[model samples]
Target chain A: AQTVTQSQPEMSVQEAETVTLSCTYDTSESDYYLFWYKQPPSRQMILVIRQEAYKQQNATENRFSVNFQKAAKSFSLKISDSQLGDAAMYFCAYRSAVRYQGGSEKLVFGKGMKLTVNP
Target chain B: AAGVIQSPRHLIKEKRETATLKCYPIPRHDTVYWYQQGPGQDPQFLISFYEKMQSDKGSIPDRFSAQQFSDYHSELNMSSLELGDSALYFCASTQGWGRANEQFFGPGTRLTVL
Candidate 1:
């Protein structure tokens, strides 16, 4: 079983500044994928970014990027130019690279980190 | 592109009562997944369906059942509900066989068991 861990339960970031949320996972499989999801007060789960375990280069989406250190089993999310709307609960999730039954694979998620962006 | 749609944005039930939640996937999406998130908790995978067939199972309780229809819509049925069953239920969908769990989630349905 794969388990994702987000050590920081809460994070505070000033507007226009940068914040890094830490996440680690324990997985025996060599092939897998890592992801970060944002849940706002609306309770919608939004995809922040994703990183493939095989890719050495980190993934970046607009102001969101990730520092994926595969060997250390760590995948951290970096939010640059943080805005007030960035306040939410961030989760780190893990998925197997292998596709199962041609669809709908499940994700194992961390407890989540609450990020607070203040002006 | 339209995202997954979960109907009955909120539902309130009592202990031992039954409830049903529905999900409509994005157009042409063949894979659908269900997740449950308790208050102040991360989402947990429940089950998934592909092509109207059960594809994968997770930590879903035995009292819960789900299935996809030919129209690509899915329904989750919960029986003998308990207070602990109160949570936000989210439905997600993905595209083809090669999809690497790039699922787009729905707005979610909040279920409250009284």
Candidate 2:
């Protein structure tokens, strides 16, 4: 079984500053995927960024990026030049690699961290 | 391209009644997923479908059921609505079954059971 944990329940950052959301996971499988999702007040879950275990390079999407530490089982999301639009509930998720049996690839998500971008 | 679309943006149902939510995936998407989101909680995976076949189901109850149509649209049905079932339901679509692929989500349907 796989599990994702977000230790920070809430985070705040001033506009134009940077913020980092912590995430950790427990998985025995070597090959897997990590993801960060953002949910705004509208309650829509949006994909922020993704990281593949096989690739050491962290994923970056404009101001959003991930610091993936495979050995430490840590995958943290960093939002640079934070804007008010960045305020939302962020979630960390994990999915196992594809198996020969064609098993289900369901995402196991963390509790979520509420990010507040102060002006 | 248009993202995932879910019908009945808001629904109000009475206890013991049945409710059905609809979702239309983006064209050419092979996988569709359903999730439930309560207030102040992360979205939880309910089920997923690929090529009209149920690929996975999470820790959902028997009253919760889903079906995928040939057009790639999916429907989530609740046999007996309960207060606890009141939450936001999201439908998502992905290009493939690979874990590394990103899933696009719909705006979601807010279900209120009284």
**Candidate 1, A18-86: lDDT as tens digits:** 999999999888878899999999989999999988899999999999999999999999999999999
Q: What is residue A48's positional error in candidate 2, in angstroms?
A: 1.0
Interface RMSD score of candidate 2:
1.9
Q: Candidate 1 DockQ score?
A: 0.69
- Residue B28 Cα positional deviation in candidate 2, in Å, after optimal superposition: 0.8
Q: Which RMSD does model 2 reach against the true structure?
A: 1.3
The predictions' CA RMSDs to the true structure, in order, are 1.7, 1.3
- Model 2: how far residue B53 lies from native, Å: 0.8
Give the distance in Å from residue A59's predicted Cα in candidate 1 to where it truly belongs: 0.6
**Candidate 1, pairs of clashing residues:** none
> What is candidate 1's lDDT per residue for B1-114, written digit by digit as tens?
788999999999999999999999999999899999999999999998889988889889999999999989999999999999999999999886445658999999999999
What TM-score would candidate 1 get against the native?
A: 0.96
Backbone clash total for model 1 is 0
